[model samples]
Target: MSKRSDQITLVAGGAGFIGSHLCRALLDRGETVLCLDNLQTARPSNLRLLERDERFEFIEADIVNPLPLDVLERTWSIGRVYNLACAASPPQYQANPEHTMLTNVVGTDHLLRLAERADARFLLTSTSEVYGDPEAHPQHEDYRGWVNCTGPRACYDEGKRAAEAMAFDFARMERTDVRVARIFNTYGPQMHPDDGRVVSNLICQALSGNDITIYGDGTQTRSFCYVSDMVEGLIALMESEQVQAEPINLGNPNEISVNELLTHILALTGSDADVVHRSLPVDDPRRRRPDISRAQRLLGWQPRVSLEEGLAATCAWFAGEIDGGRVPRPTAPDRVRASVA
Candidate 1:
C-alpha cells in the first residue's frame, strides 16, 4: 500500500445520496477517494459527475462481506473511512429487513476492522432512526431511544443502534479512532425520486401532478438538514482534533410539520395536486428534531441552509430529471436493497 499520508479516503456507500455528495466534497479537497458501493439502492446517475475525475475510483462491492483487502492494499493507503452504508428510507429498508440488519451490524464490523488495520480515522454516518419513535423531543445524543425491536421499522432502527454499539466497542477495545454522526432527515439534489422518503415523495408527487399523500394527519414533524450542510458537518466531525467517541447529532433544528412541508412543496412547484391522507406506518416517529448543542460545542458546526432554499434547489433537480426522462421508476420490491453501508 502507498503510505502517502492524508491522501486517500475510503467512503463506503459513497455512490448514494449523501455519500455521493461527500465523495464530491472529498475530491474537491484534492484527496483521492475510493468509493465502494453495490449500486443496490444507489442510482448510477448519482456517480456520473465523479466518474471522470482522475482521483475518484468506484469499487462495486458490498460491505456485508469482507472487503477486497489485497486490492485496497495495492490501490492506495487509506487514511480516512466514512461508513455511510445502509438503506435509509423506511420503505427501502423495511423491504429487506434481514439484509438491512446485516449491512448495519456486519458491514460496520468489516469497516471497523479495516479502519483498525489501516489506523485511519473512522466516521460512522448513523441515522436519527436510532432514536426510534423518540419519546424525547429535539432528541439529544444522550437519550436512549424508545424502539420497538419487533416492529416493522426495527430492522433499520435496531440495525443502526447495533452499528453504533459496534463502533464504540471498536474504539474502546481495539483503540480505533472513531466518530459517529447521528444524521437526521436530510433532503437535496441527487435524492432518488422513488426512494419513498417524505421529502422526495412530496416533491415528486407534486411535480407529477399526483395527489400528495400525507401518511398520518400530517401532524408528524421532522427537521431537515440540507445535503451540503450535512456533508460539511460530517467532514467537520471527522477532522476534528478533539476525540468524539460518542455520537453527535448533525441536522437542521428548524422543525416543521408534514403539512407545512407539503404546503411549501406545493407552492414551490405551483402544482394544484390534491391532498390525500393515509394511514401512518407502524412505529413511525410522530416528531423528530435534533438537539444539535453537542455538535455546535464540539465541532463548531451548524446548518446554514433554510428549508425554503433547500427545497427550491431539490425541486429544480427533480424537475430536470422528469423533463429529461432520466428518473427511474423503481418498483417497491425492486427497491429492497441495503442502499448504503
Candidate 2:
C-alpha cells in the first residue's frame, strides 16, 4: 500500500462516469495517474477534466488485449492498478455482451497479472448486481449471490462474479495485494448522457420535457450512493492496510423505491413529464441494498451525501447535457428542494 512519489497509479476506464472522478481525486492528492481506457462506452469529454494536469497520462487501449506493459515498465513503476474497466450500464454492456464478459474475465486477469508483476496493490470494482433479485434484504458480504448465469444481464453480473473469484484466488495464492469493493447504485456528474441508468435516464428525460419511463410499476428498490462518496470509499479500500482480500460493500445504507427516486428527480427537475410504465428488463434485481457494517468496521467508510443533495447535483449535470448549460448548477442547502429545470 506504500508508494514512492514517482510511482504511478493506473485506472482502467478512467474516462468513465465514476472512473473520471477517481482519477481526478488521485490527481488532487498529488498522485501520478496512468488512465487506460478503450473509449468504447466512455466519452472524450470526461477526459477533458484531466488532460491539463501534467501528472496525468491517458492510454487508449482495451484490457482484453495485451496491456502496454512494455511502455508501462519502461516509463514508470506502477504502484497501483484500480480495475474499473468494462461497461457498467445494462444497455452499454448488453450491446456487446461478448466484450463485456471478456472485459471482466480476461481484462481483470490482465490487470491482476500486471499488479503482481509490478508489485503493486490491485483493486477490483465489483458490482452489487451479483445479488440478483437477492433473497435476502440488506445484502452482506458473506452472501454468495443469487445471480442468473444465463440471463441477458449476466454478461456484466456473472462476469464481475467471476472476476471476484479470480481476484480472491490470486490473493489466496499470495500473488499480489488485492481488494474488492462491491459497489451499489452510484450516480452524479460526469455520468455519460446516454448511459441508460435509471437516474440519468429520468433526469435527462425530465429536462428534455419527455415522458418519464418507469419500469415494473416503480416498486423495485435501490440504494443510491453519491459519486463523490463512492470515490472516497473506493480510495479508502484501495489504500487501507487493514483490508486484504475480503469484499467490502461500499454504498449508502439508506434505501428507497424506484418510484421514490423518481419523485425526488421530478421535484428537483420541476418536470411535469407524464410517467410511463414498461416491462422490467430481464433479471433486473427486484430489491437492492447493501449492509455496510463491514465497510464501517473494516475501512471506517460510509456514504456522506444525502439523496436529495446528490440528485440535485446530478440533475444539474444532466441539465447541461440536455440543453447546453441552460439549467444552472444546483445550489440548494441541506433539507431544501430546488428545481434544476
Candidate 3:
C-alpha cells in the first residue's frame, strides 16, 4: 500500500542480484515498493536494509502461481512493474530447465496480464542471451539471433525470447505501455558465491588463489556491465515513454576475452593462480557485445564504471565477507586459507 502520495512500483524478483539494486533505487526515489519473490535463488539479506522502510514491503511469493490478487487489491495503485523473477544464471537456470522456461514464459505471461489488469506500465528484464551466439560482432537490437531451440541453454535463451514476444503481443494488441531491456553480463557485490557466472567465478577463484578455469582456449569474449550502471540503464528505460520498445540492449561495449578477464582478476586480487583450460559448455557463445546506439540515442545512457574499478569494489566486498566469516571458503590456493585463519 502506498503512503497516500507515493506511487507504488512492483519488483517481482526484488531479492536477487539485479532486483535488489532496483528496489533500492525505487526506494531512493521515494516510491512505495512491493517486492514479491519466492527466495528460491535470492538471499533475504540482500534487501535487509529495506526492512525498516515503511514504504517498502517484501512478500514471499512465487510468480508461477496466480498473481497475488489480495496484494493487488490492497496496493492496486501500483503504477509500474519490473518483472525480474526468472532464474538468471546458467547454474540456477540449468539446474531445473523446465521450471526456468516456465518462469520466463509463464511468469511473463502472468505479469503482463497483471499489468493489463492494473493498467500499470511494465518492464521486462530480458537478457542478451536472447541474441544467442551472434553472427554479428556487436549484437544490435534487430538481430534475429542464432539460438538452437533444442539446446540445453535454450531453456533460458529461448524462454526470454518468448517472454519478449509475449510482452510485444500485449503492448501491440492490448495497447499496454511496456518496455524491455536485453541485459548483458552484469556483475557486482551480492552475487551468490556459487552463482557460477563468469565474473563471480573469476573473482571468487582469484580471491582464494585457485586455478582460474577458462573454457575453450579462453577465447570467448563478453561485455561486462557493473550492477550500478545496469540499474541506471533499467531506470532510464522505465522512465522513457517508449511503448512496446522491448528489445534494447543494455550492456557495456568494452569486450574482454576469458583469459584476459582472468589475468585482470588475478592482478586485482594479487592472487597467484594458474589459468587452466577446460572444454566449453554446449551452446556457449563464442563472442558477445552490445551495440548501444539505440540506448545512447533513446535514453542517453551508457555504462560509466571501468572494469578495474568495478572489480576492485567487488573484490573488496568478497574479501571482507571472507575475513568476517560471512561467505564460505573456497577450494583455492593454500595462501588464502592462511589469511582467513
Candidate 4:
C-alpha cells in the first residue's frame, strides 16, 4: 500500500473512528496524508495522535458541500482518495436522515469527481446495511439485497447503495479507478462509547453496571470484525491489482447473537447487570455475516483476530473510557486488566 514519499493520500471523515485509524496506517507507511472531516459525527480525540505527525494534515470540511476553495487551491498531488465521510451509527445517521442521504450520494459524488480530476484511485467504505434485513445469510457481494427503500435505515442503506452505483459509474466511464468495500459490523478501541452500536452499547452497559439491553428476542445475529482486521482488509483491497469497480465484502464471518455478545462482555467486565429486552428497531437486519470469499481470493485476506480475543480487548479499552470518568468499579475483571496491559 506504500506510495512514493511525496504522494498524498486523502481520507474523507479522517477524524472519525475508522477513518482515523486508516490515516495513521497510511502515515506509518511513510505516505503523506490529508485527513478531511467536518466534525459532525467525528471524535476530536481521534486526531490527537495524528496531529503529532508532520506528515498528517487535517482538513475541516464536509463532502456534501462543494470542495473547499482552499482544498481545490492546494497544489499537492493526491494519489489515493478514501471516502469514509458519512455518519455510520444508526442513532447518529437517523437523527438527521436527510443529511445522511446527502452525505452518501452527494458527498460521494464530490470525492469521486475529485479523484477524476486528480486521476487518483478512489475507495468508498460502503456498509453491509445495504443488505437490509437480508434474507441471505452469509451475504455475498453479488446479492442485490432486500433493503426497504422507505424504511428508517433506508437513508444509510440506500444512500450507500447509490454511492456504490455512482463510484462504479465513474469507473465505467473511464474517469476514476474505484474500489468499493461493503463493510460489516466493525468494533474496537476508539469507538465512540455512545455510538448506539451493539458492541459499544453492551460493553459500556456492562462496564457501567447498567442493565444490558437485548433487542429482537436476542436471537438476531451479527458478525463482528475488529477494527484492526477491517483496516487491514481495506488497505489490502485498495492495494490489490485485481479489484476495480467491484464491491468486495470486508468483515469477520464469526457470527454471534445479541444475547451471546452480552454474555461475553459481562464475563469480561464482571458485571452483574440484569438483562432487559426491547423490540427490535424497524428494518433491523435479523442476520448479518459477510461471505468474504472475494476478499480471500482477490487479496489473500481474512480476519486474524478471534471474537473472544477482540471482545476482551474492547472491554479493556472501554473500562478505561467509562470508569475514568466515574468511580472505579470494584467488579472489574482480571481478563480486561491483562488484555490492555
**Model 2: residues with Cα > 4 Å off, grouped in runs:** 69-71, 74-76, 325-341
Error of 3 at 190 (Å): 0.9
Better of 1 and 4 by lDDT: 1
lDDT (tens digit, per residue) of candidate 3 on 1-341: 11234567889999988999889888888788899887877866787877778888998888877777656685458788899998787767877788888889888888887778777888999999988889987999999899999998999999999999999988789656788999999998888777667887788877876788776898899999999999999989888754245578899999999888888888888999888877788999999999999998888999999999998889999898778877776643222211100
Candidate 4 least-lDDT 10 residues: 332-341
Expressed as tens digits, the lDDT of each residue in 64-158 for candidate 1 is 88798643574337788999998888877877788899999999998888888778888999999989989999899999999999999999899
Please write out the lDDT profile of model 4 over residues 255-298, one tens digit for every residue: 99888887888889999989878778788889999999999999
- Model 4, position 230, has a per-residue lDDT of 91
Q: Of the candidates shown, which would achieve the greatest lDDT relative to the real structure?
A: 1
TM of each candidate vs. truth: 0.94, 0.93, 0.93, 0.93
Ordered by lDDT, highest first, the candidates read 1, 2, 4, 3
TM-score of 2: 0.93
Candidate 4's error at 185, in angstroms?
0.1
Model 3 has a clash total of: 0
lDDT of 2 by residue, 1-341 (tens): 58788889999989888899999999998999999998877767789869999999998889999898643563338898999998888877877788889999999999998898888999999999888779998999989889889889999999999999999999999998999999999999887666668887778777877677888899999999999999999999998988867999999889999999988988998999898888898888999999999999988988899999999998887777656763333221121221110
Q: How much lDDT does candidate 3 score?
A: 0.83
> What TM-score, to 2 decimals, does candidate 1 have?
0.94
Best by TM-score: 1
Indicate the residue-level lDDT of 125 in model 4.
98
Q: Which pairs, if any, clash in model 2?
A: none
